[model samples]
Target: MSIPILSILVFLPLAGCLLLLPAWNCRRLARPIALVVALTELTLALWLYASWKGLAVNPFPQGFLLLEDAPWIPAFGIRYTLALDGISLLMIMLTAIVFCVGLAVSWDSIKERTSLFLSMMLVMEAGIMGVFLALDLALFYLFWEMMLIPMFFLIGIWGHGRRLYSTLKFFLFTMSGSLLMLLAIIALHLLYAQQTGVSSFQLQELLKVQLPLETQLWLYAAFFLAFAIKFPLFPLHTWLPDAHTDAPTAGSVILAGLLLKTGSYALIRFGYPLFPQAAQMMTPLFYSLALIGIFYASLVAFAQQDMKRLIAYSSIGHMGYVAIGIAAWQPVALSGAIIQMANHGVTTAALFCMVGMLDERAHTREIAAFGGLWGKLPLWSFFFLLFAVTAMGVPGLNNFVGEFLILAGTIKSSPLVAVLAFCGIVFPLIYMVRLVQEVVFQKERQPLSLNDLNPREIGILAILALLDIWMGIHPAPLLEMLHVPVQLLTGGTP
Candidate 1:
């Protein structure tokens, strides 16, 4: 009852959305409304972070912050519950940033149904924040489904060419997976009740259920299916490139920056810990899938004509590193995976954003459209160059640290995987450098009066850039935060 700050973080956006309801003579107020809502969200998020810094021990592993719980569906033992941990803390932070930046970035791009647009963005942000913090299976599932709706609408309504096809494909694929997860969640709940006599959806309760190996295997597989689809791992990944390519700039940012992490989060928070034996048993298969995704996606990326599609494919490949890192299960490997998840969100999202600028200015995403843009947009070129370096894990940027940690951690677990994954690093450099050369130095015609990043865009990119450097140089804090969680999950002590 202490103000439930986390609830404020989750639901304020829904409240902010009502401010857009009158929708009449409010056109002038649309941007201001959205900005105020996002800033308010940001303030709360920062407050939680600053508060977290002052706390002596993480209250998350016991359960999340500002805890709240109540019965929602007593017949099914499902309760409405939500909380936060360090893992979800990072996710919440990313969601807040994406929403704020997405809102700001839309100051010029979105025109029709301005209020509706901002409203959807806020709802999506709130929904995703809910997903990260939800501690009840039912609550988590609700938030998970909530995320898909706004994204579907955003794509269907505001996206570029052939948005309908892409949106429908995304919806169908994700919906199917969600249904499977629902069934699995129900099974997990039943198992909990049968074993414990008291039915509850509290994650802490479920985490304690000593499930039989067979049930655990089946449950893990079901949950893994749901997660793999979201991670878009290998054969299950067809929906991603299309989605990223067709989605609007803000859409791509959320898709790459935040949505993908949910899968990995579920894996760490639920899948791996609850079904450690199953994960260890099937590690080989998952690692192989990860390796295939890495090479296959990268190979396909080099062949892409559309820059957005290229970045989309690139996401699959980078996430492949994450999957591989997680599968290794060594402390270093797991830590690397987590670090890489954050790094990828920051750098890849920035890349997609810059590419969005290119698409907006040139009206083309084709790699061949531009040449000699370096002379025209020095500032844009510099930012692009910096992010491109980040993408490839250049030594100075944050990406390098994450990749190095992952590679080193994974190698300690399995040398073969480390060797194979090492081969894929060269490809990032090749594609990123080539894309930069073509976009900046090779293009002949100048961007027709295209200016560089304005103050807002620069602000967003600069924060990311600073983090990219700071994390790379001094990852000590993050490493410390990760050590205990990673050790606990992996059956060891920090």
Candidate 2:
């Protein structure tokens, strides 16, 4: 009876893409159209957040809210199901905000085949929204793979040197993991059918059918491999630097801002809940890998000369914190992990956008190529410093709150992980400070002539900066929204 708000939220961008087809020849119209659509999605997400009843009162049935379920395939028992909770709601909001900012920043930078580029971005957005909303396993997988195509084209077509190689590698790595997940989805569906005489890919329905420990372990591994590759956890993270280094600015923004979050979201939404026993068994392994990634990625980040590549490695390290929190499985840790996902998304996206702005003007991303920018571009320098310190988890910034909670929670669960993670924090500080010194404060290497950020760029960075500060100062609303769901996930009293 009520309007299908979730469906509109998911498909509105694709509809925008369709509307753009008529105006493809009008290069000027493409960005405005895309911006309008992206902002509309953001507005809807804000509305959803505003209207949401707190979890204390509503307590999502099976960890879902704003559900829209309907039978799409009666014969196969596959349904067109969508739902949201605090976690998915936050992810969708992040996707919308990032896409809008990404498009705003791309307006002047992306010139060649602008229409196609904007279209791909919208399609990618639609796919990401679907991933956050879909409650059916089949639907979720569809959205998961849907996002890859546009990104491949974005990187392969619009990217810098080594674009083709990087695109292929990114595609292959992601596709391989997705295929494994697909196989696991089928196995779960069949196993459910065997137990209940009804085949379904709905997550809630499947959750009720228990599997043996061996089966759980096998299935969990399949899903974990898929998520870990996307999360780019440690050794599985080889594809990321290449992808980030060569991707176009918009490509890098979406990849860092939203694509990576999907992996951690999936891990929380499906991995642990579906295979609790295996998740329990694998906690130690996850903690070890997360700790290793935290240290190894931070060290590698410090040694990088390419600014984009440095930020890329920094992403791995930040996500490693998410992994550590998730593995700890305490309510505080899980809440921190969820918040960290958004925190890292904003901070890293800002970093990549700043680097892209520098690269656009200077034609280089080498740290040595930049110096004395603080004198030339004070506004840019201030934002760069703000986001850099935010990334380092400086107190009174977004990353600090999430990192603090994660460390405190990990200390309660595993003091050793907490200590190792604390030590890993030092490397990021060294690298981020070194970056600030070389790029902003040090004397110019070549007396560069760079302009301050334009109104558009400043607007994007300002929104992100304010968000970072706001989250740091007042994280209660976010933490409260997450509290019940996190407690439920951790098997604690909600």
Candidate 3:
């Protein structure tokens, strides 16, 4: 039998979490140990990607690669199952990279309770990996809920002013949606049992059990609500800015990079495929909501004085494009949406890391407080500008490719949505340029001595910058990986 490599990848960080307990008293060793563990996980992800690329057979249409299915509950048909496809592979890679970068960024900032912080980070990584790998609905739900604990602790214990409020709000919003999803899962399970005379939560098995359109609509809403809350679509987005503003730098990176993508991933993996008719019927509503979110969040971001808050709002707008592309339900649009997930993860995480660096030095996240930083911290300003241009969807940057494909695909379906999304792009330019102008070009507001980014920080930003450029110029590899899977999902030709 082949090794259960997928399980190893999913739980390696949990192993790291356990290993971290013994080193709890040694503050100096905590971060180094965590970094090593994160890098190991990243290495495993890269290997998985390489192995997948070399495979002669396409594993996605057959359901997944490195698939593992073993009976766990004989009576109810629940199983210990995990697998990966192009989508899961890319998301796993992003999680590993972001966690490593997040840990590196926290090296100097987290001075107290170092062990607990690193342990929580590892646990969060484990949970995210599990979410990406799980193929059974019950298993997926377990991993989905597992992510909450570590993130709650990270934000509530290690965050800034109003952390408690932000933590509670974030928890309540996500948990409430999760409960509705749980109900829907149980309902689906029971319905499947009634129809097939067997109980199961296996996604592939469940996909074969078709429900009536009315039933699909109700079930889809339950799933969509859960994902939308996590996606934080439009009005449900209230919890996001607060969470991003108050959470620690590492927490913000994880939230922006990995957590937000899970919502879109779930929609693609489960919500749409499991309820195709309902998904088609609901497309217009989702497109409308996404457009509104883009316009609304971008407008709000322009008015923000706090740097983190501005970026927080900007994330909502960026994700709105992902939502639009997914709702379009075209293979090209879905491919764009998936690639955009990675692009947004890399670009936004870098932005948050840069803001964290600025905050660490200046002790403030206020835009007005940080003027003429280019004069004092040229390297820092340069990195910030790079990511800012990427965020603006500037040509020859990562964002431009994804946004262009999304617009192209969207226009084929709904020219109006394409037009509206195009208008939304302008808002990012307004706020992003405003951000660059006030922070980099305008005169310094206060007389304060500031240091530029350190070697470690520069390395992290440089890696992300290179990835942005590579994806912008030649996204063929990313698009190629997802081509079969996206075509399969959308029932379209590559």
What residue pairs clash in candidate 3, if any at all? Answer: none
lDDT of 1 by residue, 1-494 (tens): 36777788889999888887875356678778878988988888777766765442545455344577778899878888877655667678777877776776667888888888888888988888888888888889898899889999888899988899999999998998899888988888888898889888777788888877888888889889899988979999999998898898989998998889889888888888778888888899899999999999999999998989999999999999999988988888888888888888888888888888777777888887777778888878888888888889888778888888889988887899999999999999888888898888884754466777789788877877887788788877777656665777778854
Tens digits of per-residue lDDT for model 2, 186-279: 9999999999999899988899988999999999999999999989898899999999999998899899988999999999999999999999
Model 3 C-alpha lDDT per residue in residues 162-218, reported as the tens digit of each score: 999999999999999999999999999999999999999999889988799999999
Model 3 TM-score is: 0.98
lDDT value, candidate 1, whole model: 0.84
Cα deviation at 465, candidate 2, in Å, is: 0.4
Misplaced by over 4 Å in model 1 are 23-25, 58-66, 443-449
Stretches of candidate 2 off by over 4 Å are 54-60
Question: Which residue segments of model 3 deviate by more than 4 Å?
Answer: 56-63
Q: Against the true structure, what is each candidate's TM-score?
A: 0.95, 0.98, 0.98
Worst 10-residue lDDT window for candidate 3 reads 55-64
